[model samples]
Target: MSEKNRDGKRSARERLAAERAKQNRAEKRRRGLIVGAAVVGVLGLAAVIGVIAAGTGGDDGEASGPVVAPSGAQGEDSLAIPVGEESARSTLTIWEDFRCPACKSFEQAYSPVIHELTDAGQLKVEYHLATIIDGNMGGTGSANAANAAACAQDAGKFVPYHDVLFENQPAETDDAYAQDATLFELAGKVEGLDTQAFRECVEEGTHDGWVEKSNEAFRSGGFSGTPTVLLDGTNIYQDRSMTPAKLKQLVEEANQ
Candidate 1:
C-alpha cells in the first residue's frame, strides 16, 4: 500500500478508538446518573414522609402530654429501648417504624441472629421507635403500638411483645395497630403482659411523646429510611451484601 493510504488507515482506526472511548464515558455517566437519581428519590421520599409526620403532630396535631420515657430506656433523651446486657462488647442501634413493612422484613430476616447474639451476651440492641408511617399513611397506629411496647417494657416483656408486634404487623396501609383493643389482644399472647396497668398505659398513649420525640430524632438524624441498622455505629443494613451470617461474623470478630 502507498504511504498516504497507510496514513489514512491509521487515522480511521484512531477515530474509531476515540469514538469507542467517548461512548464508554457516556455509559459510565449514564450509570452514575441512574444511581444518583435513585438515592435522591429515596431521600426525597423520606423528606415527604417527614413532612407528613410533622403535619400530623401527634394524635390530633401533636401528642398533648408529658414526654414519659419507658422503664429502662437509655441513650440520649431516653429514646432507646435497650435489649441484652449493658456490658456487651457490641451495640447495634436500630431505628424502626412499626407500620413499616420494610422494618418487619428486616426483623424477620435478622431477629433470630440478633436474639442469639443478645442471648449469648455478645451484643446489645438499642431500639429507637419512629412514627413516620403514621405521618405518611395517616393514623396513630405507629404511636399506639410504640406506646404499647413501652408499656410492655414496663412489665419486663418488651422483647417478646416487640417480636409479636412485628409478627402480626398489618399492611402498611392498614391502621390495625391504632386500636387499643388490637394491641390489648396481642398483649394477651405474652403471659403476664395484659394487666390493668398495661391496659391504661396503652389506652392512654402513655409514651406518645416519647415515640414522637424519637421520630423527630430520626427525621433530623438524616437517616434514609426504616430498619436503619447500625452495628457498632456502622450502617450495615444499607450494605447490599449484609446477611445474618455476615452480621454474626462481625459481632464475633468484634468480641475477639
Candidate 2:
C-alpha cells in the first residue's frame, strides 16, 4: 500500500475505536441513570409505605389503643337527618376527617354520585365530620377545619363548606385552610349561609363540641378509618374503592 493510503486506513481505525469508546460511555451513563431512577422510585415507595403504616399504627386491625372522645357528649339526635329532600327514601351518612387524604379520595370518587342521587331525590347525605385522626393525620388544623365545617352546618352551609374544605385541603399539613377570612369567603360560596353567623360560630369555636361529639360517636360505632360511609345506616368501609356504579348498586340494594 502507498504511505498515504496506509495513513488514511490507520486514521479510519482510530476514528472507529473513538466512536466505540463514546458509545460505551453513553451506554454506561444510560444504565447509571436507569439504576438511579429505580433506586429513587424504590425509596419513595418505601417512604410512602412508612407514612401509611405510621398513620395506621401498624394496621393490626385490633382496637388496642385508648378510644379518644369528648366527655359527657351525647350523639346528635338527627345524626341521620335527611338534607336533600323529604321524599328521599334513603340516607347516606358519611363520617370523615377533613384532613385525611383518603377522605379526599373518597370525595373525589363518590361525590358526583351523591350529587346525582340527591338531585334525583333518591338519596340524602348527612356528613358527620369526625376528628379522630385529625391530630395524627394532619394536626390541630385538621380539628380546626372540622370545627369550621360544623359551624357551617349550624348555618345550613355544610355541603358548600364541605366542598370548599376539600378543595382547599392543606396538601402539606392538616391545618385549617379556611381561616376566618376564608371561612366568610366560603360562606359566600353557599347561597343561604349568613356570613356573620358563620364568622361568629367559627371564631368562638361554637361547633368544636359538636365535632368532638361526632368523633366520639364514630368511635363508639366502631369505625377505624376516615371516610367510613354508611349507606342507609349500614357501614360501608369500602368507600375508598367504591365507584359510581358500585355505589348505585349498593344504594339500590339498600333501598330494597
Candidate 3:
C-alpha cells in the first residue's frame, strides 16, 4: 500500500476512537443526570413527609366531641382547686394526669400529710390537670376524668372526688374512664358529687375544653411530662431520690 493511504487509514481509526470516547462520555453524563434527578426527587418527598410527621405543619383533625374550657382559665394557677385558706403562706402546685400511674402513686403516698397541712391552714395546693396520657394512648379517658373532676369541683367536692378518682384509676391500657358511666359510677363513691348538676357537667363535657387548656398551659411552661410538683415556685422533683417524707419536709421548710 502507499504511505499516503496508510496515513489516511490511521487518521480515520483515530477519529473513530475519539468519536466513540465522546459518545461514551455523553452517555455517562446522561445517566448521571437521570440518577441524580431520581435521588433529588426521593429526598424532596422524604423531606415533605418528615415535616408533616414532625408536627410542623399538617392537616388539622378537629374532634366533633363537645368541649368547653373553664371560665377565666389563664394558667396553672387558675386551673387549681384550692385545698386551704386563700391566705395560706405556703402553696403546693401539682400538675397531674388522671390516667398516669405515677400520679396515683404520688397521691397515695402523700395524701395524708398533704391533707393534714391543708386542713391546718398551713398549706394550700393548686391542682393542675393534664391529659398527656390521652394524647399518647388515643382515648378520651384523661379528658373525661379531668372533666368529671372539674364538675366535682363545681359542686364543691374537688378534694374528695380527686382522691377517689386516683384511688380507682384504671390501668393505662384499660382506659375505662373514657366511658361516662364509669365516671358517674366513680362519682357515686364521693358523697354529694353524684348530683344532677355534676351529672350534666360530666355528660355534656362542659370542662373538656378546660382539659385542653390545661395541657396547653403545661406545654407553654416548657414541661415535657407529668406529675410536676412545685412548692413556692420551686420544683420538688429535681431530686430524683426525694421521698414523700422529703416532700413534706420541703413544705415544712417553706412554711418557715
What would the per-residue lDDT of candidate 1 be over residues 102-172, giving only the tens digit for each residue?
A: 99999999999999999999999999998888878888899899999999999999999999999999999
Which candidate number would show the highest TM-score if scored against the true structure?
1
Give lDDT per model, in order.
Answer: 0.92, 0.68, 0.81
Tens digits of per-residue lDDT, candidate 3, 1-256, equal 9999999999999999999999999999999999999999999999999866754221133324434544433333466656786777888888999999989988998889889888987788888898888867768799789999888877878889999999999899889999999999989998877988888998888887667666667767887577898888988766677777886776677678
lDDT of 3 at 148: 91
| Candidate with best lDDT | 1
Location of the lowest summed lDDT over 10 successive residues in candidate 2:
65-74
Q: Which pairs clash in model 3?
A: 68-209, 69-210
RMSD of each: 15.2, 11.7, 5.2
Ranking of candidates on TM-score, top first: 1, 3, 2
Q: Is candidate 2 or candidate 3 better by TM-score?
A: 3
TM-scores for every candidate against the unseen true structure: 0.77, 0.62, 0.74
Superposed model 3: Cα runs more than 4 Å off: 1-77
Worst 10 residues of 3 by lDDT: 56-65
